[model samples]
Target: MQAEDSTTLEATLADGRRMTLSLPATDAPWAADGLRALRPVPPTHTGRGEEPPTLPEQPALPLEVAILGFGL
Candidate 1:
């Protein structure tokens, strides 16, 4: 493990290329804010009147072939 010298930070690519990037360091308030921004926001609550109809469930295939009386 290597220790970081200065507060300077950069990102490394898989192609052995290094790029100077600006990113919020861990434990920083900006990092927490960034993560919170990335999270999905919940939809706003609405007044309910008529309920929507639910779809019918599909029947599963029978495992007993002989019980179904199918000709071999």
Candidate 2:
């Protein structure tokens, strides 16, 4: 969908998610250029109805960094 002064784009990802983006008229040209530069690639899915892979949990880092020469 498009408004008088802006353009709206709707898209779906390979993971079955939906997204919407709105850009002002001045920046709309970049969106067109980006779309024109897209190249098709093989899909990542390997099985039907399989959930997406997730990252392993990471330990929280120590907050011992110095700020302005003063240790926190």
Candidate 3:
């Protein structure tokens, strides 16, 4: 197993929000094998006769990753 390391990353989102993240420092390509898909949630607080309108399916946005200053 690789030794755990910490690194800080800062970025400005498209909506002008600044965000920071702390992640493990490594030179290897990241993997998604440990990730699991999320389940859908049922609607809440519906009226006796009101029905929620069906939403159009939207394409998933590509993930963005930053790997600044990897390794100690």
Candidate 4:
């Protein structure tokens, strides 16, 4: 794999799949966010037509604690 430029990258996978990615810029944080956005979401349930067991809900947190936790 090699970067063609600040906004372009080229690579050939093990299975001979050639890839080229051209981005708006070379910012690492933006690239990471883009990669994370491209990832597929996993299914919530197993494929066996059965729902996963749900856990009992806990009591809600105090408003101040919830706000602090969101910062972290």
Candidate 5:
């Protein structure tokens, strides 16, 4: 199973019982006290307009490297 959130990545476990790590639920993941203690900050905002910022565009990569190394 994969946990969906700010990023996407696959997870693997060796044995069913040996998988002991626990993760915060995406739903109600942050508690008031936890968030307050963490004092998390958002990325600095930029732009003059009220519209949301678009994701940064990526450049094309070398064909061989992309295919062999990344399988992209």
Candidate 6:
């Protein structure tokens, strides 16, 4: 599936059918929401007996130094 242009979008179904749509500016938000709804949800993790992975600890930064660095 791919967006053809600013006003056009297209997709190829698993059964080999090609689908296309001509979108008007007013319906852009609806089109966006429709696309989002079509996305597949990821499977949840079910660790039977395995231990959860641990991330390495990161060094903490000084609060004043971090604040001063933000704008730069």
Query: Highest lDDT, which number?
Result: 4
Q: For model 6, how does the per-residue alpha-carbon lDDT over 33-63 read when each residue is reduced to its tens digit?
A: 5433444345486458777899999999889
Model 2, global lDDT: 0.54
TM-score between candidate 3 and the true structure? 0.26
Q: What's the count of clashing pairs in each model shown?
A: 0, 0, 0, 0, 0, 0
Q: By the lDDT metric, which is better: model 3 or model 4?
A: 4
Assess each prediction's global lDDT (C-alpha) against the native.
0.51, 0.54, 0.45, 0.66, 0.46, 0.65
Tens-place lDDT digits, model 4, residues 1-72: 666456666777657999987767445765664432443345588557868899999998889999997896
RMSD of each: 16.3, 8.9, 23.6, 13.0, 16.9, 13.0
Ranking by lDDT: 4, 6, 2, 1, 5, 3
**What's the TM-score of each model vs. the native?**
0.21, 0.32, 0.26, 0.35, 0.21, 0.34
Residues 1-72 of candidate 2: C-alpha lDDT, one tens digit per residue? 222223555567767887666544445555665333433467787668867899899886555533534643
Q: Write one digit per residue (lDDT tens) for candidate 3, span 22-72.
A: 554455555232111212345675558867899999876544322333432
* Clashing residue pairs, backbone N/CA/C < 3 A, model 5: none
Which ten-residue region of model 5 has the weakest summed lDDT?
Answer: 31-40
Worst 10 residues of 4 by lDDT: 33-42
lDDT of 5: 0.46
What is candidate 1's CA lDDT for residue 23? 42
lDDT of 1 at 68: 75
Where does model 3 exceed 4 Å of error?
1-6, 24-72
Steric clash pairs (candidate 4):
none
For candidate 2, report its TM-score. Answer: 0.32
